[model samples]
Target: MQSLIQQYFPNVLLLKQEFINSTIETLYMVFWTAIIAGILGTLLGVILVATGPEGILKNSVLYNILEKIINICRSIPFIIMLALIQPITRFLTGTTIGTTAALVPLVIGVIPFFARQIENALLEVDPGVIEAAESMGTSPLGIIFRVYLVEGLPSIIRVSSVTIINLIGLTAMAGAIGAGGLGNLAITRGYNRFQTDVTIVATLIILVLVFASQFISNTLIKKTSH
Candidate 1:
């Protein structure tokens, strides 16, 4: 294996450029998607919770509709959703390949998942606080924006960390379809050419990235909450 890697070292260097480019692409895709989805998902989560049966703004009709929609979207596997949303991807980015084009599907794919996480996190908040806010005559939206957001910031950060890590993994899978990312590099240069070292290297990099993100986010959550 050492000799084989030595023989391909120069070629691997070229492919390594592609891997780096792919990693950057994946980062780009994940960051933008997280930004959009984070904002929108938080809103959706607040809405979902606030409009539930016991919510301050409870509305069975609306909550049921939103719930079903979220479920349906979340039910679709990421890979199939990639193909399914190709037209929208083209319309959004003018192409069905590359990192930018992948954003559409990634955002759509991640939003519901994040929203669910947000909902669960917020639900973990003490109801007494919400009740206290209600006694202060806070509007439904006010309760969510001020009370829930503030009180749940730590949980939000924690869940957001998880969501981000998952998004990174999805971004890699997106590479399988023409979306350039580390996953694409692994599949193309590593798997296609049977370059196991390339695959190992990409995997190690991703693991490091995930661990680093997790550590940083957890530290932030701890510091902020305390």
Candidate 2:
């Protein structure tokens, strides 16, 4: 068993601990960034939905401002955003390198993208449902939670899966800057060192993460949908 294992994926088997640590680092960045950005992005999205010109509570000023901001931030490429936001990252994390620092840009970078996703998901809710809720004198907050959130949950899960997959890819880019994740391992040791096996292993792990997230999202969507 060991000999066959050694025969294939030799670098990964040899650098087992590095691979393990790098994977953990990758998960850590993705986990925290997703959580933080998820909440903020959701809020941004909810506000956008609630305040848009066609929203139940229209506030063009707020909606337009938030829309422009989301566009500006989302327009910036993640790599350049990493460099562009370094000062802020340094201020937030007290340094601009490693897994912790990478998180700042990760969350900031994904927030706009996720916010747009959330807005789109919520917008998919039937306008008639919201109008009916308004007829019943259901408060704006009530409709948002009961109608928009409840009806849009399946879509939310789907978008979340997409966002997470994109985030995982971003983490790999983050690894390029000494964030020390699977990307770093793949780049510094695998690609840089011409070790194809290690690169394949890292790529495989990323694929697993994406597929697993998509599967879970699909299951939830099925269950959540009527």
Which candidate number would show the highest TM-score if scored against the true structure?
2
Candidate 2: where are CA atoms >4 Å away?
none
Clashing residue pairs in all predictions, respectively, total: 0, 0
Model 1 residue 36 CA deviation in Å: 1.0
lDDT of 1 by residue, 1-226 (tens): 8777677554566676776787788789888999999999998998988898878888999999999999999999999999999999899889999988989999999999999999888887789999999999988878888888888989999999999999999998998877988888888888998887788778887898899889999899989795
Give the Cα lDDT of each candidate.
0.88, 0.93
Candidate number with greatest lDDT? 2
Model 2 TM-score (2 dp)? 0.97
- Residue lDDT tens for model 2, 89-126: 99999999899999999999999999999999999999
C-alpha TM-score for every candidate:
0.93, 0.97
RMSD (Cα, Å) of candidate 2? 1.0
